[model samples]
Target: MTTTSGNTNPASVQLSAQAFRDVIGRFASGVTVITTCSGGRNFGTTASAVTSLTDDPPMLLICLNKSSTSAHAIRESGTFAVNVLAEDHVQLAGRFASKLPDKFEGMAFEKDGNGSPLLVGAIAHLVCSVSEQVEAGTHYVFLARVEDAVAYPGHPLAYFRGAFGRMQMAPDASVLREVRERIITTVNEVDQAIDLDRWAAELAVGVDLVHRALIALVSEGLVRREAGQFVIAPVPESIIFESYTAKLAIELGVAESTVGRVSQGQLTQLRQYMEATFEFIKDDRFTDPEAWIQANERFHEYMVELAGSKILLDTYRRLGLPGLNARTINRSTYATAELLNDHRKLVEAYENKDLGAVVEVLREHADRPRQLRARERELFGRA
Candidate 1:
C-alpha cells in the first residue's frame, strides 16, 4: 500500500503497524481454534486468518504469526484440526487465545483421525495435513488438504475490528426483541454498568448482539453510556409522550381514510377489543397490566389496520405503543376509566361516520398518556 498527500510528489508512505492492523481488521471472518499434537502434547491457538482456497481438491489456507508456539507445534506434527467455533463457544475461543501453558487442561475432547483435538461444540471441525508452507512477512501461510470435515448445524462465531462476534447467514431482528423483553421483565438491583458478556450468556446470543442492543437503547433513553460503561436510565417522558403523539398522528390519518368505510364486522372487532381493555381493569384483572396492554394494543391496532396495508399496520406496531405501557403502568392504581371513556367516544364517532369528531377524539385520547406521565412524575419526581 502507498499514499500521497496534498499534491506532493508521489513518495512512498510506509504503512504504520497500527494502520495496517486497523485496515485489515475491518474484514470480518469466522473464528477458529487451530489444534495440533506435537510430541504427544496438545496445542491450540485462536485464529481468524483462515479461508477456503478451493473445493476441487478440498484445499484451505491459514495464516499464523511466525512466533506462535502453536504454529511450531503444527509444523512438528505435520497435521492440525481447524475447530470452527459456534456463537456460544466464546469462553473456549478465549481459552485457546491466551498463553495459559495448557489450553486443553481439564477439558474433554475427541481426537480426529490424525490425533488432533476435535474441540467439542465447535460448529465444524476440519482435520488437515499441511501440504505446503510459504513465508509471509511476520507470518507463515500453510496450504493444507482437508483430510476430514464435519459441520454441525449452528451459527459461526465471528471476529471483526479486533473483537469477537457472530456472523449472520440471514438477517435477524430477534436480538432486539429479546433484549427489550429482558429489560422489561428484569429489575435491576444496583444501578451499575451492564455486563455485556453476562447478558449474552443469559440471552444465548453473542456479546456483539448484546452490545448492539445496549448501544441502541442509549438513543431510546432507556439506557445511558458513561465513560465506556452502560447504566439503565429512567424511562424518559419524551419517548412516552412522543410515542403516543405518533400513534395519534397515524390514527388521525387512518380516521380520515376509514370513518364510515369500516364494516359492521370490523366495528364489532373494534368493540370487542376495546371492551376487553375494561375487562382487564375489572377486580380480578386490575393488577394484570400485561393483559390490559394487549387488549389496548388490539383495540388501537384494529383502527389503523382498517387502512388495509399490512406494511402500514406493521409500521404502526413497530412504534411499540404496548411496550411503553409495559415499561410504565407498574401499579394497580393506574386509572383506566378516563382512557376507556375516550375509547367509547372514538367508537361512537366511527359508527356515526363523523370524521370531525373522530379526529377530535383521537387528539384528546393521545393526551391520556401525558396525563398519566404527569401523575407519575409528581409521584416519583423523575425529571
Candidate 2:
C-alpha cells in the first residue's frame, strides 16, 4: 500500500526499499520448497519467507517474489504444499531455487492430500488451500488454511546471508564423556558385546545418540564391529606398538618425499604445529593427556600432509594413534622432554631441507614411545 500525499518524499521512499531488504536479510529463516499443480503442470520453487499464522484456524502465510511462477500456479490452483527441507537437502533446495526449465524433472515426490507435490525426505509437510492473497509491492503474500500437516524427525535447513546451511545443536560434551567412560570401564573384556539400549537407559540418552557415540569410538580404534554388534577392541601393547611401527614407515616416506620440496607457507604451518606438539607438556611434565595426543598427532599429520597423498594421509589417520596413546600410556608419568626435543629437531631439519637429518630424527623419535611405554609400566606398576 502506498500513501499518495504531497508530503511524501520520493527519496525517502526509495531509500526505505533498499533499507528494508538489508535489515530483514539478516534474520534467518527455515528453507522450504513450495509446490503446486495448475493447468495439468507441476510447479515448484524454493521459499524462504514462511510463518505460522494461527493454530486455532490451522493457517499459515508464505511470501514469494511477484515473478515467481510457482506463486502464480498456487493462486490458480488454490492449493500448495510447503515442504520444509531437512539439513541434507541443500542440493535439493538449490535446484528448486534456480531458474531451471523443469525443476521437478527427475525428482522424487508424492502428492499431498490437496494434490500439491510433497518432497521426499522433507522434515515437515504442510498441505494448504489458499484462502486469500495480497499483492505487496514486488511480492505476493498468500494466507492459506493448512488442511493436512505432518512433521518427521530431523533437523531443519537454514538460510542466512544468502547461503544455505543447517541449524545445528552441538551434542552435550558431558554426554560424550559419560559414554566414553562407561564403555571403557564396563567393556573390559575384549570381544564382549556392547549393550547400547542398556547404556542409553542408564545414561538417559537416546539409543540413536548412543549408537552415534559408538561409531566415534570405532573410528578411534577403541571399539570394533563384529557380527552386526559393537564390541570392545583389544588395545594391548602389541597392537599399540604395531600402529607405531606403521606410523613410523609412513612418516619417513612423507618426510623423505616432502621436506625438501615444501613451500614456505607449508614450512610456516609445520612450525606452528611443531610448537603445539609440546603444548600439553610445556614444563617437561604431562598436563592433559587428550591435549598431548592431539598436539602430537597434529605435528606428525602436518609432515604426512606435506607428501600430498590423500591415500597416505587417510591410512595414517585410520591408525588412530591419538586414541591408542590414551589407552596404552598412564597419565602423570609420560616422558615429555624427548617428545618436545624430537618435534623441535624435525622442524629444524625441515627448515634446512636436510632429508638425512629428517630421517635420522624420525627414526630416533619412533623409539621414544617404546621407551615411554616401558617407563609407564615401571612407574604405574602395570604390565
Candidate 3:
C-alpha cells in the first residue's frame, strides 16, 4: 500500500475502490461556500480548498477548477467571499456542490456590508476582493484581500475527501497524559549509537516519543517552537510580528515568568549569570557576538525556567530571546545596561513574590525596547 507520505508509488498500492475511498478520507478540510457575483448575477459553490494566508490586512485564498462557471464569474468580477460552513449546513453545502440550475433558489442570504453575499448561518465569512490569481494545472487560484467579515457561533463543517467531519477538543487531562506518553516514547526511540551533540543530549528520549510529543504539543495549539526551542504561541502576531509591541511583550513575559519562580539560591545563580554576562559585554573582549548572544539567552532562560510552566519556558526558549536579535546586537544597538536594570527589577519582583507587580513590570520591560527600536527604524529607514 502507498503510505500517507506518498513515499510509495500510487501504482504499487493495490486497493479496491471502496478501500481507496476509506484510505484517502484521512485528510481533513474545512467546508466553505465560495461565492462570486458578476453581471448582476450571484453564484455559489461548495469548496474545501479555502485557507488563510496572512492576518496583516487579512488575506485568504480559494482554488477553483477553471472550467467551473463560478470560477469564471469570480475571475470576471475580481472578487469573492469564502463563507466557512457550519455543521448544520451540509444540505446547503451539497446544494452548492451541484451544478443545479438555481442553487440559491430557496436559500436565505443577505449582501454583507461588503458587496459579497453571505449565507445567514455560516460559521465565519471572509469577503475578499481578489488581489492576484495564479493558474495551477486546471485550477485558477485566487488570493484575495479580506475586505470584511462576520461570524456566528457554530461548529465548523469539515471534510475529509468524500465525507463530512467536525473538530472536537480533547479534555486537558487526557491531552497532558498523551503528551507525557509521547515524550516517553521519543526519549526511548533515539538510536544510542548515534553520538548526539550536547543539545540533542538534553533530548534524551525515544525518537518516536520525542516526535509524537512535539507533534502533540504543536497540535494542541498551546505551544510553538519558532526555531530551536519552544515557547507559548502568541495569541495574535498582528501586534507581535510587525510592531515593536511584539518584542516588549516577549521580554515582559520572560521576565515575569522568571521573577515569579526560583529559590534564593536559583536567584543568586541568575544574578551571577547576569553579572557575568554584563561583564563580558563590558570587556568588549568577545569577537563572536553569537557566543555573547548565547550567554545572554541563557540568563533569560534561567528566568523563564523559574516561571514553573514548562510550556511557557519552552515557548521562551523557542522565541530565542527577542532582545538579542542578531541585527540588534551586531549593529551595537543592544541595551545591555537597560537589560541589567531590568534584571534588578526582575530580582526585586521575585523576592517580593508579587505576581501582579511582576507581570506589570514585565509588560513594561518588554514594550520599552520594541517601542524604541521602532522609532529607531523609522528614523533610520528600515534597519
Best by TM-score: 1
- What is the clash count for each candidate, in the order shown? 0, 0, 22
Candidate 1 — number of clashing residue pairs? Answer: 0
Task: Encode model 3's per-residue lDDT on 45-157: one tens digit a residue.
Answer: 89988888999979988899987899999989888888899887788988999999788787888875545678888998888898999999989999999988788788898
Model 1 sits at a Cα RMSD from the real structure of: 9.3
Flag regions of model 2 displaced more than 4 Å.
1-26, 170-204, 209-383
Clash count in backbone of candidate 2: 0
Ranking by lDDT: 2, 1, 3
> Model 1 over residues 1-383: C-alpha lDDT tens digits?
34423434445555678877888898998899999999989999999889999898999999999989999998898899999999988898899889999889987789998889998888899999999999999999999999899999898898899888977543137897777646543444225677888999988989878887877677776778888998866557687788788888899889988999989999888888878777666532245777777888889998999999898898787777776677666545445577788899999898899999999989989997777657756875755
The TM-scores of all predictions, comma-separated, are 0.54, 0.48, 0.42
Candidate 2: tens digits of C-alpha lDDT, residues 60-121: 99999989999889889999999999998999998999989889888889997767889889
- Model 1, residue 381: C-alpha shift (Å): 6.7
Query: Which of the two candidates, 1 or 2, achieves a greater TM-score against the reference?
Result: 1
lDDT of 3 at 89: 78
Local distance difference test, each candidate: 0.82, 0.83, 0.66
